[model samples]
Target: MHVVEAPITITGQESRPQIRVAPPGPADRRIIDEDALYMATTTKASPVAARMARGTVVLSEDGNVFLDFTSGVGVTNTGHSHPAVVKAIQEQAAKFLHFAGTDFYYDVQSSLAKELAHAVPGTFAKKTFYTNSGTESNEAAIKIVKWSTRRPLLLAFTHAFHGRTQGTLALSSSKAVHKERFFPSMPGAFAVPYPNPYRNPFNIDGYDEPEALSDAVLSLVEDLLDAAAPASEVGAFFVEPIQGEGGYVIPPKGFFAKLKKILDGHGILMVADEVQTGFGRTGKMFAMEHFGVQPQLTTMAKAMGSGVPIGACVFDAKLDFAVSGAHSNTYGGNPIACAAGLATLRVMREEKLVERSQKMGDVLHKELEALQTEFPRIGDVRGLGLMQATEFVKDAKKTPDKDTRDRVIHEAFLRGLLLLPCGKSSIRYIPPLVVTADQIRGAMDVLRASLKAAAT
Candidate 1:
């Protein structure tokens, strides 16, 4: 209905996508041109103008529907515009909009906070600090750890992306462009290696020797604490259970537990940036659950509000700022956002989306690994649950082949399957949990077709 020339429709359960014409056609250009003319330059992956979406199907402005594998960059875990979430948004909008819940009392805000505290993995008494996005959640975590531990230095991993804010940005070292003009990031932020199974500083193949990779990284952390960043001065060790922007890199099996043990000995706290991996993206409720370690602070945001702008820093109650005004935001618990959050939680529970993520993730992973076997360019296929990716390589040495990856993305787009890229030369396939086995197979088939087209 969005485009007169295009009558194509796609759904979350099937891959029967039809594209009468390539995207960025006449119908997509008016808005795309206007956005280019007026909008600030951001990470605009493609010009597929999305008019509306339902479940995993994105109806573009041109009426060219796409099988959305990006999940709106992992924010819509329950699928796009679920009827329950939309109804909650509608009902809440009718009641009241803004009430500064940070200063005043609100039942919905408190209820959602309690739900998050219970939902996030941790046995200790936890509290939630609401924010509008993942960066702010991480920002609150940074402030809390510093205030609680009173340490000047923070530890993070190389190729780690916390956020774009100054404090979280200081902790982020994933890409040089993120901090290009930003000079002298927050001081005393120590950087180190993550236990990447594919490639690492030690040149150990992580797939073959995961334990060794973990041990070498652990040894370096200890040396850093003893040397440049003294344990007495480090506040917390900030980590991603699964690196998001850096790559869909999964740390070795016991890496986080071992790191937690070391940090525990040094009087340091662990902060898991679950902004991207939270809300059942990685088969578990949170990726930290995958590691079996409870972080003192867990920063979450992406899927918490199911498309609404909401985020929370759920930390152990012991770390709550001693004073109220130490860190507060104006719209921490906006009423409508809370309603959407509550609805998202219910949808996940009633629909059993977390279990679906695990089941569908197994299917996706198997298919991707199969693609790896078929395509020599696929250097590595790695991830947990629906959060998956394939790294492109020039040869067996695994030199990044970004051109091929980008071309494949463009080719897939033309064929009606939308995807997002990650790391140096990889495409991440993070379809919503609601996606079906048939949809997964169809998407992979499209991927194979695009791969062949890109190769030529």
Candidate 2:
């Protein structure tokens, strides 16, 4: 299969979001109405109906051009329908569709796995188990760690979002609504405090810096393990290198290394959930690289396939399941998904998107920091690379201002910009890695105007 050398450029003003009509226009409104009647309640993320999406902008059925900062919740890392990825999908589709990788041999699956094993952090021989989504990857991690270590207990941080499935839902603590009716999740999962210097729960002395905060947090975990959960029974501590749904929270610089040390001392494993942080989203190939720690198991999805659905659990080769049928998915690592993944990885490397993300993240940090200075409501602006957020507060006291956050999002949406809210009162700005400097500035301009409009 031949790879495309350049992006498929859309000519004229159609390249970017152009608003010929306000979103939810007559046609969009009709579709939205029918969708509400037929689709599941949880299916939609915004009111605007998207008919087509390309690059950093989405074309709403109403003819509005929306700057998609959400990037389908960080899935389209290479931007929507990246030319290379599209080409790969088309070529693979022509050959064949399914030949289960779990049960049968497939060249694409092995090829993609080899690529990922090399790319994912680890000095030892590594292996990969493929799945269809982030939650599935997390479930695989849970299984691999448990089966390998013969441990019964698992640990996760508060505000952590592993997935919506029962096993991972139990690991999550981002919101009660995600688990309101689904109780008795999986057994033996415990939640611990995730150190956020901006919102310190322990309030330990000298908690201002990340190092001290992580130390205190680790101490708290040790105390809990001793007093409550036993460390010997704990299989692994699953954590997002940077918390996503919990408000785009970035832990202090030395947080992961320190946490890894404590876990190592206990003979417990560290599992990095890179579903949202993988594929150069955080300026690194994987967020764990930024932390200077290699996890025994790492779960990835989101941008792994660019826009295709694929997830994987990368772990030490030593952690493979003993039984062949112990865990397997029919659709996992199918030829098409693997082909898309291979193309996505190639595009990331060829485009040098990782370095581009770092440069763009600096741009976002500078832009958002300036906004923070101008808007006292913006209590904090934090994140690395393209994954960043602005936490709004009521005043200098730093009380969460969910109302303003909501208003700002709606206003931005009205103005043809899309932003997602996380952790109650924070707006997460995760534009596609392919986004340009001018696009960032343009989105910021829209945000600034929206903030002013919401204020009035």
Candidate 3:
């Protein structure tokens, strides 16, 4: 498998090539003003309006070429407008755009389902149900878990982000901002402590002694179950193998293993939400594989379709459930989207993108660690594979300095490097898996400069 080593060029121009433009030009300003008038201000908007994108570059209406570290909030893993994915979508569209599998049958949908059932980590036979987005997929997982176990309560973790849907919002513990206006969320959802070593509730130190922290988290789970509901009443425990929106929080080793043991003891199913960590983002095809523990159910999206809207809830086949009308979606298994997903998976395998993500992650981690050593504001630098983050702090005590983090992100954006801030005061650096080592280094340089500028 040959990885693209040369800097990506669009239309014969080198990556990050300079482009002339008038700042906040007519097109950008007009669109921004129109958007503010027509669209709800629920979601935050970036300064620039995107015109077009190729590879890891997002060309804005103002003619700025920004190296997209966000990847459309971690959706474009195969990179923007990947030729193979584009070709598949176009070819599929020529044949049929939407078949509405709830009403009709489609080969593409079945093929994608079979592929996911096989690809997701597990030795047992699995079944899959599709959805339009990550939140929908998570919502579907919740229903499946309840139906399979005949239980109502679910166990989630602190600082975990499931999604914004009413049902998912109930499980998400990231921030109040996403749930402030929304009330009366889905009930029977409980929160537990995630094994975050940095702000560990146990106050443990260092990665070398992860067992103690793991024990504390496991104990908390047991205590929560005892207080809230009985073990049999809990349907499943939803966990993001690597917390994407939660500062890329990678739990300690043996954490999941121990948690899995407890859930198994109580006959509670484990549901791994790989919405952000799956599809080679974490180097492995599935993040749960790193723990050697198979989830009874799994949810995936984001990179699964390589920027297309698609998600899946997969589960062990042995779980008793009816397919007659248990759940359905209008565009869940759209043929065109399925084709895009199949092509994305093919590209990942044939191009060895997972291996590339792992290799590049090593280089990125080392470089970021060096920056952390130099910057006092960089309190912690941690991640798995390509899903990485550097948390800003006011001092060595790890006090969250959201202002400094925001400044760093803003400065990097102005310098043609786009970054996404996650958790409280952390900047998540999740670039495309197709990104080259040099691109990673270039982005790092921009971040380093941005941190320095923001410091003063």
Candidate 4:
């Protein structure tokens, strides 16, 4: 895949983005104090503060340049401020920017919807409902599932992170921290074991033997439906093709295929939450394509708008509700966001970024695997395409070592690379699809050095 390099020019830009000044730099300290005084204390800060970003680099307020492996939490797959995306935003901003799609019809929204319908897998006629975030998309999907099946129960998997909204939060089982105080969650949501070969729920072992583990996970789903929700009462089964925030855990090869069969048997719909795994992050347009299973409804966000706030739920025509006012959002299909989405999809196809991600992922996987062999702390390295993670453990026995992983991330940050930790002790390397091999190598070298420092 050949990518045409776009020229970048930043006015009044400083030299390098990575050289941090001394601790408590006046500018950094002032902003941190202001944030502590006013902002919510929800997120854990990583010291560096982002002032600007381009390609795979984030420039911090303290004049530090960090190689961004998080990709703004997988929302910048095309890279930060890609010329194409910026041009689209600028062009759209010049014209009509935010016309409510519901109040008035817009070409950009309609065209983007058509593109998404076609891009998603399955030959069946599809329709789309746009939203502002992954959680909103999942919320729309939940409403669609209930309206289509007239069922109230939703089945999700353990260790799944759908979103933080009420609807998606009910379906999410990622961690207690995200849900501890917020619950009195939406009712009738049940969880089944997801296929994790590393910490196999069935006590089975080996990644090579994923088929049997998949079967065990499927059996638990069957039992859950039988005991938790009756066939007539279940609405949909929601799953992430490759679990994102719960760790970049990829299930067995036949997991989705067999799970689809079980859902079919119970006449339940399958909803694929491709929020983080969609848009070429998983080597394919949608992760479910890897397993050869087409979902009844698919929710996507993350890279859909190339860092802009846009998300959508694409579903089979059969699931379109007949009655009006079943589900709606004021900012569902903003024109500006649609323009961004259109530009993102066009850039991805024209540049063949999906294939680039696949090739680069192979390189990344090899490097991480080499590190795993050299560093005993890295217990597992797993991923699909660019969506990969390295799980750290005290030993091969698979005990989560959050302290070591956190230290590694901090060390990498200090050395000019940015990494994000997910699950318990796993570091996910989700760089932009536009990331070059050289950039990947640079980031991996930082990771290697950080692991060594953390291990010592």
Candidate 5:
């Protein structure tokens, strides 16, 4: 498989880290200062201002050319400004930007919707609902399930990061800060323990006995059905095939299969939130494909449009809204975004990025496992394909080391390797599928140096 040498040859995306004047230089500081004053306080991972990027290379405002492993929080899977995606966007924008698909008809929106319906998991007839982001896609799923099943309750995993929208936020349990001031989220959502192999509540050594971990979690799920949130009342299970923000935690093998058996028996819909894990991030088109369970509904965004800011909730066609006006978005399926999405799909297939993710993911895991062997502070290294993470822990007991994690991230930024933090003390390494094995090695080298610097 041919890996992209650089995101773009003419655009000057650095193949490796090059810290010229250190971070927060005059230009970076200027943008940071303006942003602090004007922008609302949100999740700001690093102070480095992105001037431009291509593939896995990011050119910061400070003129520091950095290797980007974050993929803009798992959005740019086709690589930064992929030529095909760029051309499609330009061509579409030249024609028209937004015609409001809900009110009007457009071939771009319908074409992309058809593609999404096909790309998403499930052999059963499917339909697509376009939205603007991950949260909105999930919000659509929430409506679909509740409206279809007429069930008052929804099931979500503990430590799952669904979204910030009030409806999706009901299912989000990653951080209290996300829901601290916001009281009374869309009600009737019950949280269940996710079968996180590394740090589950049961303290089972899942790496040694994955089935045992699955059994323990499945027991609780059964209990939930038997007791409070009964299966009859639960409309759907909002699950991330591989938990992203809650840490790149992959559930134990056989867990999903068991859980799906139970959900099927109860006739509860399974909605896989592929927002972060979709579009070859997990070496598969959708992470749920790895588990071999076909969810009735799938929510996707992030990498779908190759950074064009689009999302979709593909559901069983039978669950489509009976009323025409029940759910509709103003700018959804915008021509530019849809065109970008179409181009992204083409690029993924034409470039064989999914296969590359599988191949390079082996290389990434090997390097990470090797690195884990060197660093005792690294409690766990888990993930699939290019979407992987290392949890920083204090000891064998696996206490989360947030301070150490933050320090490592900061050090990495200084060294010109941009990364993002997930869960409490885990740093996610999700380079675009276009990322080469050499880029992974270079990023790992920066991580090794960052880990060493943070140990001080």
Candidate 6:
């Protein structure tokens, strides 16, 4: 057992979190009211009104400092306003801000593309398309596969979230609320079970076994393709190695390898969505590295530019659009974003954040597992590296306890810790890769206190 050390007080430093006033103070309330009146009703995780952020902390308008465990929903992998990234952004902005890469050429644009092509998994000659968000990357990937293969159908898994755009929204099946009233999603999208051992949909012998779960999911896909969607028309299989919004669910070992075999047999391309699992968040530079399965194409965003708006769709060189202007985007690969991306990648390599994530992940897993032993509500703790989650359950039957989960989130906020809920009944912890052992210890302590307060 990893012994619990004394709680570390991360304060006094400019980057460390320190709460002066309780959350939702006068200034925060004023901003919240203004936002509620002006902003759309999409959603708000908490009433926090952030004034500034540095590293793993956010300073709110309420004068409360918070340990940002959410990492802006997994965007700030290198932490908020990393010095190197800011410097690169400033330098690049001074030279040029925007020059449409689709029409003109920029060194930073192609340079970042080359760097990404080399960094992405797979040893084949690769090409890249830049976009502005994860959804746009998925959109580009969808077009690339369909155009390259001349196939119309695409396959995604249940509880999967690719993006919110029209084409990618059709691929997402994480929540009906996300797609509600936005009917008529893109055509020729199909869904299959994703082989989650913790919550297996297939009722088979030894369902909890990785191999058994893998076999069942593959068999289901085989049957579905045979009966519903034709294999000949399927363009690609879009998958997230670690399901992000679907509760940080990690599939069983060898699952993607088997899935790849099926897709390859059908002459279908595999599109790996690394939106939330890429850029050193998952210990490896890419989550696909963990499974040893090489994707023909990969869509990346979120942490690609360490919070800068940059997304990339990388694929084997052999795959190309059918014609000129088949797919292009304005503001893709702008100089400032590219500079930020280049600098972010440099920091990742220099600081060895990937290796740090792996080592610290071991400590985090041990601590969370210890929590599971203490709290009956913590039904499961699963994920890779810094992207981890704890599921809340109500009874011995393991039913979802969303009430308790919401309470914990609220209580954690009251205690100056920021967290986000994923899936139906789980809290995801995806702190920046720059986090330390003391910070992790502090987060776990806050979670413990929150759980206790919520239980009361």
- Most accurate candidate by lDDT: 1
What ranges in model 3 sit over 4 Å off?
1-25, 204-208
lDDT of each: 0.91, 0.89, 0.85, 0.86, 0.89, 0.90
How many residue pairs in model 5 have overlapping backbones?
Answer: 1
The C-alpha stretches of model 4 lying farther than 4 A from their native spots are 1-17, 20-24, 204-208
C-alpha lDDT of candidate 4 relative to the true structure: 0.86
C-alpha-based local distance difference test score of model 6: 0.90
Per-residue lDDT of 433 in model 1: 91
Indicate the worst ten consecutive residues by lDDT in candidate 1: 5-14
In model 1, how large is the Cα lDDT of residue 147?
90
Question: What TM-score does prediction 2 earn?
Answer: 0.96
Worst 10 residues of 3 by lDDT: 8-17
State the lDDT of candidate 3 residue by residue for 230-302, as single tens digits: 8879999999998878788888888898899999999999999999999988889999989999998999889
Model 5, 44-87: lDDT tens digits are: 98988888888889887767888989889999999999989999
Each prediction's RMSD to truth: 2.2, 4.6, 4.8, 5.0, 4.4, 5.4
Tens-place lDDT digits, model 1, residues 1-456? 585654555454556556756787777888989989999999999788887788888888777768899999999999998889999999999999989999998889999999988998889999999999999999999999989989989999999999998899999988999999997778889899877888776874443588888888899999999979989999999999999999899988999999999999998999999999999999998999988999999998989999999999999999989997999989989999999999999999999998999999999999999998988999999999999999999997889999999999999999999999999999999998999888898899899999999999
- Mark the 10 consecutive residues where model 2 has the least summed lDDT: 7-16
Total clashes for model 1: 0
Q: Which has the better lDDT: candidate 2, or candidate 4?
A: 2
> Cα miss at 282, model 3 (Å)?
1.0
Q: Estimate each model's TM-score.
A: 0.97, 0.96, 0.94, 0.94, 0.96, 0.96
Candidate number achieving the greatest TM-score relative to the actual structure: 1
For model 2, the local distance difference test gives 0.89
For candidate 1, the lDDT comes to 0.91
Error of 3 at 301 (Å): 1.1
